[model samples]
Target: MNQILPLELPNGISLEIKREDLLHPFISGNKFRKLKYNLLQAKSEGLETVLTFGGAYSNHISAVAYAGKEQGFKTIGVIRGDELGDKITENPTLKFAQDCGMQFEFVSREAYRLKTEPDFIAKLKDKFGSFYLVPEGGTNEYAIKGCEEILTDKDANFDFVCCAVGTGGTISGIINSALPHQKVLGFPALKGDFLKDEIRKFATNQNWELVTDYHFGGYGKVNEELVQFINQFYQQTQIPLDPIYTGKMVFGVIDLIQKNWFLDNAKILMIHTGGLQGIQGMNTILKSKNKTLIEVQ
Candidate 1:
């Protein structure tokens, strides 16, 4: 866990971040937690292949590829945007996945939206044969089970447990394991209250809620201000944060602190769910748009 030093609030609020991002160099953070049992289950089921879905620069796509390689399972990534099929070299995430031996099945955005539909899944099964399926963002019962282990008994001392919400898996797991007195605050990477419903499906505890004010537009969207904040934050703490998830959560948490959202002397624990690998891909987009790039190490 890394203690945040720059956030000097008036109410004596202290923030400690769990560096789940440091859990692995590639499959880090919630991805690491989410994939643990799913991979084990695949092995136990005698599955020789793992298949999942994601977008162009999806951390899930990249992590699943690496995890599959490490576990000796053939992996296939059903990537959204068929146009991306011809642009693999330009995308860091896809290129890394390819190097890790993950095959890609690029589909239209419309088709990708039907990923949960039986017909679409049947088509994939027909093409890939029998494979262990992991949903986009790696959220499932096993994923949630793995995530529930994120918070340890030692974390019971904190009054608030905060994390970036994506696909609702990580926070759901945190919500399930959090101490009764610890309120789990989720800062969503995407724009919507729909996440609350999704989170409720897995997180049985009522101690968690979403703070939805800092998306910077929506998923995979960013502006100059957010870019500057992420870069400056890296400079200040020597910690690299991915703009899509952790950066937004940290920004919101500090903003909330400035607004005196928590009581005096509250201890907040932020889960640094890693998406750092996506920075290179995001920087590529930022550079083309003539925007400030994420300062990656």
Candidate 2:
């Protein structure tokens, strides 16, 4: 954990960020947390293969691929776009996963929506044989359990705990383990109130709320302002943030602070849930669009 002192702010308001991104080089931050017990469970079940879902540039896909490779499990990624099948070399995340020996099962976006359906799963089982399944975004009871350990006893001093919300597992774990005096604030990377219900299913308390205004359009959507902010934030903080999630959360937190949304004398702790691996892929997209790229460390 480190205090952020570069940004001038209101008196008595201090900001600190947990460098969960440094937890691992590839399987970093919340992905590590989300997969900790999941891999263990798979091992205990004697499962030799792991299957999961993600989009073209999904951080989860990359993390699971590397993790499975490192842990000696065969990995399969159900990618959302069939067209991305031949474009692996152009997409860093997918290419990295492919290099890690993750087999790709590309499907149309519409068919990907049926991932949770029994028929879809049955088809996958028929094609790939038996395997352990992980949900998209890597959220589940085991994921929440791993994420609960993210905050240490020393973290209890902060008045607010902030983290980027994706699939709600990370924040749900934070909510369950937060100190009585600390409020957990989640900045959702995707649009919709649907996450509220999804979070409620796992979170045990009412001390957390999702901030929806800073999504920058929705998941995988970013504008010039967001891109520029991400670049400047890295320049100032020397901490690279993925535009899809962490960058938006940090932007929202700073904006809220400037607007006096936090109480006077509040100490805020932001969880740096890692998705940095996706920056290369995002930069590739930005280059094609003539947009600014996120700074790399």
Candidate 3:
């Protein structure tokens, strides 16, 4: 079982860490929460295989691959990136997926975009045999149900709850589970306010809203400010946050607090959706620039 550590922030804001990083070997982090229900639902329905979508280095893909192997379910990942079958080196995500016996299928950007289409999902089954298809970010009803467990386990009262909004599953779950008195804030990594509706597309009720303007740059974009935030956050919490998902969300949360968005002494629970391996490349890219990334916070 993972630990939920309580944190006392410098500004008098309090929160609890789900410590999902301690979940298991490969099936770790919020990924477990995000994937648990879909897998269970598939099992309940007697589906023998799981099919999902992701990029070359998607944490979702990594989790699905490892979980599928451990649970003895056939798994296929529709990957969107440069073809890797001929490459000698693979990103940690891809390498882990391969190690877990996940079958990989490459799709062009055009075809990959249509995977969510009913016709496209049907075609996938016709081509690859029978499978239970999950959306790219696992944004299905079952995924939301899995994520909702995070809130159910908490008995202590918190004024607010926060998490990175990728496919909005976790936020949707949190919103669904949070009572009317609790506030749910989602820091979306994407630009624009479009995700507010996208989040509601899942299961969020009146208790939630996506903070759309905090993406430091944009979806998948990072800068020195975020680098500084990640370094300082790691130094203070000993939690390694990748720039892609968790780092941006953390940065947004800190900014929200600093900006007085939260009541001065409000208690909040900021979830760390683990994707630390995604930073390996960013670290390499920054190291090549010959500057040590440090947080001044």
Candidate 4:
């Protein structure tokens, strides 16, 4: 539970990465905060199983699998995609998952969205026998409680706090902790203008703004510039960022800084929401010439 680990920026700004991603190899990153409330509700209900949804590279699904394994609960991930992919090879998140002995169930994208269906839950209950369902990102009341624990006892010198807003849990928690004088900014990873409405529907905030410009090509989509930024960021700072969620947020943060959005000496702590495992597919998609480009004879 070590919080507020500090690092300094090149421009004489003192910053911290808020080592939440180091919390657990499996339950790593902000996903833990989002899942905390749902986990408690499951225990209170005497449920021995937990089910959740996510895409092929969902940070939420990975977190749930790890949490269930660590807590000794039967974990099932309702993955959205065609039922394919090698589960044997460990991608980072799944490696810890396999270690914890979590189970997975693959469903088509259509079925995964019916997460709230009575028949769907009933089917899961029939198969798994009395389990709790954690919504996609595990963002709920307990997530807020877990996130509320994040900003405790930090340096009082910070001008503002910034983070990637996916499910709105982390930003909401920061908003709760910020004083009336402080400002909370969320750079969204979701595509289009629909995310603002989704933010309005789920989050407990009226002041937070969603910066839609930096999400790259939408959730889980990236391009050359983002890849270069990650490479440069790692070479310079030794910090690796996952492209889909946290990577874009980091890029957005840096851009905002360069534009003088924050005060010259403002202290901004960027949360490194861990998706290190998803790098597999991202690398697969990226075709930098430096990576071994042998000409076919």
Off by over 4 Å in 1: 4-6
**Residues 135-213 of candidate 4: C-alpha lDDT, one tens digit per residue:** 7877777777777666666534566667788877777777776655556677788777766665555456565677788
**1-297 per-residue lDDT for model 1 (tens digits):** 666667556777888888999999899899999999999999999999999999999999999999999989999999999999999998999999999999999999989999999999899899889999999999999999999999997788899998998899999999999889889999999888899899999999999888999998999999888888888988888888899999999899888888888899999888899999989989989889888888869
lDDT-based ranking, best first? 2, 1, 3, 4
Query: Model 2: runs farther than 4 Å from truth?
Result: none
Clashes of 1: 0
Q: Residue 167: error of model 3 in Å?
A: 0.7
Model 3 whole-model lDDT (C-alpha atoms): 0.76
The TM-score values for the models, in the order shown, are 0.98, 0.98, 0.88, 0.85
Q: C-alpha displacement of 55 in model 4, angstroms?
A: 1.9
lDDT of 3 at 234: 74
When summed lDDT is taken over every stretch of 10 residues in candidate 2, the lowest stretch is 2-11
- Residue 199's lDDT in candidate 4: 52
Candidate 4 regions exceeding 4 Å error are 1-14, 85-99, 201-205, 287-297
> Judged by lDDT against the true structure, how good is candidate 4?
0.70
RMSD of each: 1.0, 0.9, 3.1, 4.6
Top model by lDDT, which number? 2
Model 2: residue 12 alpha-carbon error in angstroms? 1.1
Clashes of 2: 0
